[model samples]
Target: MYGTALPTRPALHAEWIKIRSLRGTVGALTAILVATAGIQALSAAAGTVEDGSLGEDPLFAAFFGINFGQIAAIAFGASAFAAEFHNGGLRVSLTSVPNRTRFYLSKMAVVAALALAVGLAAGLASFTAGQALGGASAPGWDTPGAGRAVVGSGLYLMVMALFAAGLTAVLRSGTLVLGLLIPLILIVSFVIGGLVGGPAQYLPDRAGQMVLRSVEHGALGPWTGLGVSALWALAALAAGWLAVRHRDA
Candidate 1:
């Protein structure tokens, strides 16, 4: 078993370097930061606590930019894998790292790491900017579930990125992944969610968004909702791994 298992550090390092050298990766990360902060700031400024609605969730407004930021995150993840399928890039990569499992794992590791870092930074900045802009109307940092919401915002972005990356790998086409996912996330999920009711909460985007709320009224709790989203990501990853293992590069 040990003989068949290759060391992964070199593969990880190579993947990391590949990601760093890509200008698109940097641009995507920058978009996550800028779009998230800017949108959250605007939302905070525009938000008002309506009379007789003291039960409103301020955390939702603070992290509203996550709605837009996740698009950039998905783009980053999709592009990372999509590049491999272009210009015979997958063949070249396989030549250097023949073990498809190891190569795929390294690629995903890089995607997850970069997404986590960018997500965390964007989440924090969005929260800070929202708080600053919202002034007294903003959610208190000490509010019961504020910390969890902030941290979960970052985790949610990371998982969503991973989910996209996995789907890209399985589909072997970033264009397909984006076409299917962007609509599912932005339109279909929301539309169907309203009409379908309970089951819609189990959808990946809806499940993940649960963490962004300071108060929970949904069928799934915060952690449980995130777990459902993780299941979606994991299912996609398993399918992608099988594709890499048996399919021709």
Candidate 2:
């Protein structure tokens, strides 16, 4: 019976189908693409002069839309898992899979895959649109760190989604997770970072944004900053896994 049980691949396929069938999921992804590209285009048109500050970072301008688009990514990830907690969805899923670890991991895997796909598409579209609008002022493929920044934008978005997903799993309520995270990302982090100075660099959003900078001199460099954000996501996932393992489904 164990040997004949559904495998991981089939489970992932089923999760994928479930994800695609959700209108909210599709809308969130569409929002990511449209908002990212549209905002970047506007920023490019406005154009920025190369000052000595971080504002001079061309890569930053190219991917500026991420500031807004990340909200959609977070929503996508949170809703994907949080829905399981409603209407006995998680209980039904567990009845089919039986293994809590396998079921939770499969759900997370699907969330990550979908987030990465949308992130990459949004990142590339933002880059292309920003460059076209910025003309000579925009960073090109030849610019130093341009490739990394462009690619890292996608990674940043993916990790942000995963972070939301993990937190949603732990909380078992998308509203609670979003309420905490949205404010933290959009407001509290920046306010505290501004008031406190250097420590703000370690905030998940700030740390991840490090990769988007063409010129950076902070304690955490691009890759290292991303690593910090990844750690945050992993920790959240661990907490979530523990929650699901021990809690009543």
Candidate 3:
């Protein structure tokens, strides 16, 4: 029987199934690999960075995917909640669970887990593939910050996805969240940093950008860059939690 009970097995199981079964979410992770690694290959072939540009730096250019993969990340975040709204499943879910908070929290957990797995895979694959292709890469393990950059690139993806998911929670509409987050992080953030001059360097996205490089060019170092990104994630997630508490499911 269709159980419409509050916080029942059906709701939790259904949500889990929904996250796994969602094509957009699954494919987003895969794109992380394709975007980062594929672009790295292209960049190497294109001669964007010189042979020793990233000398022992682990091929910083491989992170081209981080910029590209944001598109897929945006899609995953939007679909995480938007699909339900589009299909009127949100109504049914709310009715079944009765507690909006629990329903929303469950979705957040599932989405975060998905993002983490995809991010880690993308980060590791990008590094390995980039190095193999760009032989004598600048950021090889011999470099001082090579390892950190490699690890941080992967972590950065996870954080960005988390930030996007939280943004979706706040907006509660797929189109709105996607529209806002993409521009805010990609376009607006970049512009503001450019206009604000040297000081804009502290912005979350810019700060996090350091992780993509084998060397630290910004005010903050690799770990600090990640820390800046984490702050944004926390802030965004906090906003989302408030939305979950106040808004109807």
Query: What does candidate 2's lDDT look like per residue over 145-212, in tens digits?
Result: 88888788888888998899899989889899889989989886656643423777888888888898
Model 3 TM: 0.81
**C-alpha lDDT of all candidate models, in order:** 0.82, 0.82, 0.68
TM for every model, in the order presented, reads: 0.92, 0.91, 0.81
lDDT of 3 by residue, 112-147 (tens): 667667766777776666666666643456666667
- Can you tell me which runs of candidate 1 are displaced by over 4 Å? 2-7, 46-55, 192-197
Task: Judging by TM-score, tell me the better candidate of 1 and 3.
Answer: 1
Better of 1 and 2 by TM-score: 1
Q: Candidate 2: deviation at residue 214, Å?
A: 1.5
Which candidate tops TM-score? 1
Candidate 2 at 244: error in angstroms? 1.0
